[model samples]
Target: MKKKKEPLKYHIFQNITFLLKCIRREHPLLLIFIIMQVILSVISPVFGIYIPKITLDLVMGSADTAQIFLVLGGFGIVMVLSMALSGMANEGKYIMYNDMRRYYQMELFLQSLSCDYKNVESEEGQTKYQRAMSTLRNGDWSGTSIMIVSSIDIVVSLLCFFIYSGIMSSLSPYMVLLLIVLSLISLFGTRQAQSYEYKQNDLTAAYEKKLSYVIRTGSNAAFGKDMRLYHAGGWFQELRSSLIEESAKLAGKIQDRYFASGVVNAFVLFLRDGIAYSYLIYAVSAGQITIPEFTLYFGAVTAFSGFVNGIVNNLNELNGANLQMNSMRAFLDNTNDPEPETPLALSDLKEYSIEFCDVCFSYGTDTGFVLDHFNLKINAGEKIALVGVNGAGKTTVVKLLCGFYKPDSGIILIGGQDINNFRKKDLLKLYAAVFQDIYIPPFTAAENVSMQELKTTDRNRVEECLVKTGLWEQFCGQPTGIDTPMTKEITGGIVLSGGQQQKLLMARALYKDAPILILDEPTAALDPIAESRTYEQFHEIASDKTAVYISHRLASTRFCDKIAFLSNGKITEEGTHDELMQKGGAYSQMFALQSQYYQNKEVAAAYAEA
Candidate 1:
């Protein structure tokens, strides 16, 4: 069977559409502000160009002094008004940029969370995800500003250029052709440079991914100590330098291209101005133009060049912004997952029976089945233990029961209803889980134990769960009590030991009071006494609920009412502890070996005492 490819690459125009949708939908205020800035941009440059021409007429005294003063005054008034309007427009732009940044930051955070667990493991998807994240943080508003301003500049510049072109055309039709050729050449050359930048980005993608990983591993607090203790800082530094060199090589390729093209562009600009100058000289010498007209013509030419240059620069920036906008839009476009739309909201979760019939699952198309032809029927209130060696598919069974992954072929029923028919939210509410790996939340010890939002936390319930988990006296009642944060970053807060952290995770699960409880190696790191205490507490509070215990420890299997022994992808043994021992199968062999090792230890201690 072939695996389906992920829709990861977003089309360029599709990205633009995404940006527009985001601004229109999520940031309505900012979108309005952007529109205002665009209007000001269109008005401001034209005002500046025309005002200067009017001022020149006044300075040359070619018209009535009173009329000239009035015209000059009008130009001054418009200039002042334009400056004030632009200042207000710029303020709006700042607000709009900041708002857009905040909005996208939130969107990116939500998007990261919504991604499927397997997506994070995909090298390509993860790379793209991280780039999207980085750009979201550093380039959100900066990119938006570039896009909006560049778009506005392009529109304004073209309008100003046409205004000058109209006047120049009246004087000489050839001058309009000269202006069009120069404008096209300059704009086309810059667009080529922008396109090169996009290609350079693609070429250095692998190098940048390596650099990001090296930097993150070196600097993250979780890995920092390990990196320093292992003396890996120098190694990471070398890796980063290599990535930098690779990036530089790619950049150099693009820079060489740009420089070659820029020289030709510079020559084009010079030739265009030279021709315009020749026309001016001919007009003045033939008495077709006055001193004032010559001055006006020179001013118009300079203004036209400035306007066209502005448009070229802005258009180049617009191209780059389009690329970034495209990726962001693609991510946002699929915010809704392909999962069932009418998610079942769980109610009546007090029932505690579970069943799996002909259950089959595989990690992906390339992977073999983790569980095949699996059948299990667990009665209400039964405490079952799953015992397995490494790669025995015990954990996969738990994940399947929890609805994290759907089976490729099979039916799982809860209270005689197919599990798939249950809404995801409802399914989650049915069970409380403590996995093999612990999660230490960045919160107060109370909130960590309760696993509830701080604003509405039940403090007493947190205290009770901590005590029941056997960690309250040793951890929660420290200098700051339960109010103390769990992180080791600050003083007056105690950090839990590995066993204590495990106990805290158990406490969090206990607080949920779900109908079903799952504990997967929850006491692996605990001492014998702590392990016994946890199991006893687990039996007390979770007695009426269906409990699933997954562990490698054979001794713990004895506590459950029934044990399912898994070997490879199948359950090979199912019985009570005594039954499994009497059968002398895989579970019996492991149990005997473990019992003999401890008995031998006792005998060795006795011999030492003698």
Candidate 2:
């Protein structure tokens, strides 16, 4: 089915109207202030047009001197009043602009955070989010302020144009018509220039993303050592310089074209002014107008030119803001996924037994299967260890179980009910996972480990989690303790080692206290003692929870009630650790080799300790 398109004028007008409505709703005083400014703006041009006529009358000695003095005084009074009102309005506009942008940016951030994780993982949704964020922070700062000012500029300009043009047209209608036509052409050119600049902004979004990645890799302390060790500095520098050059070139071209268009517009204005002046001279020679009339018409034409230029430039600015607003609106409008028919409340989660029947999955349809016809059953309170080599679909299983991705064809059941029918939020609350790669948020040590915002978290829970993970001493002995900021430049935050960070992450899982826990290589980087101690702690805390572990280290699986051995997306063996060793399959072979190596190392470590 074909869809209808909204007319551009209609959309622009609607946005402007909405902008005014929102501002009035948010800050009524500011609207009143701007309305007063607009009135002063309209009156200022009128005063400017009449003041010269009054001066010319006094000079030519053709009018009452007292009347001319009064006109001059009136002009000064209006000018003073307009300037005072305009100053106040400008201040209010600045405040309103900042407030409006801040309000909308916060609203968008909250909405993005609340959206489904599945949609966020989608390629299109990610791009849309990135575009909205970049535009909101960069070019959308003026917010509705630009639209309000532009609309007022256009109105005042049109009013002045008509009033002045009407008076001047009486002297020479042809000249007034010629000025009007030129004004329209200049406005058209400015709008085209604005659209070209908007496209340039859009084209730079991908470059912005690339640039951000380069910065993260090059400058971040965590990536700093890796970058140098791997000699990735040159590669990243090349990529960064390339994107910077491209962006500079594109921006330069856009500016040059816009400047050229402005020059063309100026050339047209020059010709129009020359023609109008020549007509004015002819009118004066024919004795058709007095000296005062000649000055009035001449002043009016100049005022009209200013009006035309002001309206065109304001319109272009408003058009650019509209472009940013449209991008944000499009992202917000489309990112919402279809709502579930019935929400599954978290109260419904009772048992953690999981069943997958005929499950088939792929990252994309074009990509080969990460899991094919995969089936597994984990009993309630079962500690299952998943053994697999790298890229053996180990992490995919954990992601699927956590409901981050759905199977292309499968029925994944929890407590004999299909997970597809489960409310996503409720399902998320049912499981806790510690992935291989952990995110260290720029927050306090407690907040980073607990994954809680400063405003939303309970201090007691934060303390308790830290204590459980053996990180409380380090956290509290610091200058600000849990209240400390996490960054080095920030006050009162002490940095912890990598193993300490991992323990803190484990504390977060413990805090979640869900029925199911998934730990993916939690001890991958830990020393032998810490690694074994971590599993022992997990066994103690997760005794009543369905614990799933993924690791290449076979020594870690000894505590599991059941083990699944995977190779190339397929599970080839599943049983108790003892049963798998007896089967002498892939699991048995890998286990024997690792156990032998580790056993000798442990013996030597014990001898050193003795």
Candidate 3:
């Protein structure tokens, strides 16, 4: 579908304002960068028309060698200035580009971090981010970070166009008019071609993703065993080859579009220059202009044609980039209010228990419910375990509580007030959650656990939690102790085992010690012994704090004050583990199934005693 277009003038103004902010931050580098650009833009036309005109006239007028040499010396000086400015302009572009890009990247990242929680997770929100990233990753002034440079180019191009138009006017006004009309035709054709190129980006992105999947799977040491054992190397090769062939075919189609557009532009420029040069030659032959004048007019005609074409081309590029810049703007301006501005802060959070009352939710339309009228209540400081088979909405409840997604209907309350009434960030302050997905950043262990940069740290507390979680021994072995980076993706970093990472995450949660603590399969990577030790300690550690944990191992739910079995979008069973086992319902059946191995162990031990 054709996207609705916004005005180029509006984007230009936006670009200016964007750059102005950047300039304010790093004015010295960017100011020099822009000034060098303007100087280069102006000098190109001056060299093409003015200096050449002067040299030709001087040489042709029977001027002395000494006099001509003076003019030639001036030519050398101009050349030197242009060369130096050109070098600085090119070099400064990349340098300033890196700085501006780093700045913009941080700003955009912070924007995403501060965005509405729902906006960061929804399909629509993810698409906006991908689009914004695509704009930023391009290595040119057209990229989101350097759009100010492109904006400046437009202004400089316009200024140069006018300056040259006046210089060319001595030849003929009609010539300038003719050039603009033809150049505009080329501009329109090229814009359509470029639009076609961008339309193919979705296909290109898909192809790149496929290639990335193959490369990642092939290159990763973790996947190496699977690839070798399964004999999947040939399969990967075939998949990669097919994708490359498909990309080549798509590239051909894209190139064909550009070639077709090129034909139209080539024809227009050919006709324009042919008519122009023919007119100039005729005027000179008829004695209407002298040899020197003919030389000057001929130069002007060519330069003016190029000047008109360049202006139109930049205008079209700006128009195209305007659409791309929309993605950046959309993400930055994603301020559609979902929560209250002046929300009540629950500074004292120990008094509240999270409740989901008559809650209904689905990931999207036409999908079956993940949760439906899922009513549950817990008293403050109660430790509850939500246990279920996969796809039973155990994780869904956690997400809703964390405000990652909103329920389609009904309300989630904390301390009798709707959670929606509180600021999203402030509401999140009540919980310290360790989710199933493990993401370890390449930062010091202390920073990773604290989720903050170092200024001051409670070393004793950090070590105590690490020791309690079975990670302190490994921490002490490291040269920097807890200050060691957790990823070998950086220098002198240490890679942790999966179980150790889980322990680190647990230590992180313990360090936060928020009023509400949620752990989703926190000990999945640990052995039975380690898991038992952590669960036993959790009771003491989470005392006076509301705690919820999700685990498939129903045996571990024995540690909770209450065990809730979630099934078919509702809590099918809720009670103490012994009470549920006595009731002999779904929870009992699931627990028996999950604990059958342990049951065998107990039976074997009893028989041995006999």
Candidate 4:
């Protein structure tokens, strides 16, 4: 279904209201400071226009020296007060603007974290996320920051326009009307230029996204080996240069439009000032107005031009900001699937029996189904081995069981209830899954294992898990023991070897101690002997829980209560290891092939020894 496009005014009002509400909730005093700043900014110009006229009129009339000094003193005092108050207001707004920037940045971060996992994995969702981040990271030019200033400027400029128009009307209403008409013409040209610039925003965002990717990939330490060996630095540099050139070209085009608008504005200003000067001079020569009135009216006319220009420029800025705000709002509003109104509590069940009944799913509409009519069941507390060749949708089954995704058709049940009946977060509590991609943050070993803050974590529990994974003695040698940072990114941190890192993840899963434990090729980094030992140890540790293990090595499946061989998104074979081997099916053939390879190496080693 296509979303309806909202009107410009609707976005303008909605975004402004939204920001104002945020300010009110977070920092209400900023509203007062903004109002103060606007009033002082507008009134300062009023003094510039009127004070000169008053001084000149007093001098021309030969007024008393004391009276003139008093008028000058009053002007000086007002100017000083305005400057001081304006300075304070500027400082307050600056501080609050930075605060709000950080506030909104975190809001964007949280939105990304809490949004649906599917959205995080999709290209369209990633693009929206990047756009939102880019819009907010623009500092003063960001939608949130500039909207406040632009809103205030709009109010200030409109107020000045009205006040200056009234002053100009005292001389002649026709002059005021002529200036407005010329200003409107200039405004029309400026709006067109702004529209053209806005049209290029998508191209600009794409270039920025590509440039950021290139920079990040080129600078990553993990890619250093490949880059140096393959001589790929030049390739990255060339890509970066190409993106920079494209971005520069886009910026140049936008500037060209603004340049054309400026030229048109200059011409209009020339006509506007020329006509006003000619009329004012005629009035002065005919003695229709005094010199003091001439000075006041001329100042009013010039100031009015500025007022009109301020209104036009700020309006354009506000409109541009509105577009960026729309992007930010869209990203923040990308929510997860709705939870059931009265969600079933997964914790209420003492045991969980997982089932995938006629489930069909694919990552995207264009892709073929990774799991088509897949059906499987694991009784409570049973240890199952899910083994399959690469791309056989083994991982997809685990992901579906864990509620990371919903099937396109059919249902998944846990504890004999539909999994969708439970809230997503509640469902997640049932599983402790260690996936293929390993990530241990640059935090203390204990913090990494516990997945909690160092201060709040149970050190004893972390120690126990580390001992169970056989990493306690290794970590105890470090300067901070288990409190040692996990990655070298931190000061005085120690980097873990591949096998040790795999052990650390196993320790983390053990620490979670959920009812359902999943190990997906968890021993891939270890030697064959060590892998076998670790699997046996983990099997003992997980004896009380329902566990699912995935490994390509059929040797690891001997201890599992049941072995399910997945092929073409279905279980092609299932039974105990002995039963499957006796059947001499695909599982048996694959196991024999692996066994023969190891046997060949052993025989070759023996002959070499003789």
Error of 4 at 259 (Å): 3.0
Q: Which candidate would rank higher by TM-score, 1 or 2?
A: 2
Q: Judged by TM-score relative to the true structure, which candidate is superior, 1 or 3?
A: 3
Which is superior by TM-score, 2 or 3? 3
| Tens digits of lDDT, candidate 4, 412-491 | 98878898999999998999878887877898999999999988899999999999888898888888889898777778
**Model 1: ten consecutive residues of lowest lDDT:** 601-610
Residue range 83-191, candidate 1, lDDT tens digits: 7877887777666666777888688778767765445545655666655655656543455556666766777778777887877777788887887678779778877
List all candidate RMSDs to the true structure.
4.5, 4.5, 4.0, 3.5
Query: Model 3, 1-610: lDDT tens per residue?
Result: 9765433334656766766677667656777777777877678666767666688788878889899898788878887888788777877677677777677667779989888777887866866666676677776654554456556666776777787678666778887788788888998898898777667766676776678778988988778999999999999999999999999999999899889988998999999999999999998999988887787778877777766776777776766676676667777777755777667778634387878999999999979899988999977889999988898999889999988778999999987778888887888888888889898988999998888877777777888889888889988988899999877877778998878888899999998888889999998998767887888768867888899989987777777899988988998889997799799899888766655565578763432221
Give the per-residue lDDT digits (tens) of candidate 2, residues 395-433: 888878767777889888887667766777777888888
TM-score of model number 3? 0.87
| Model 4, runs deviating above 4 Å | 1-10, 286-288, 578-589, 592-596, 599-610
The all-Cα superposition gives candidate 3 an RMSD in Å to the true structure of 4.0
Whole-model lDDT, model 2: 0.77
The TM-score between candidate 4 and the true structure equals 0.92
TM-scores, all candidates, are 0.85, 0.86, 0.87, 0.92
Model 1 residue 122 distance off true place after TM-score fit, in angstroms: 4.9
lDDT at position 193, candidate 3: 81
- Cα deviation in Å at residue 99, candidate 3? 1.8
- For each candidate, how many residue pairs have backbone atoms clashing (under 3 Å)? 2, 0, 0, 0
lDDT of 2 at 443: 82
Error of 4 at 64 (Å): 2.8
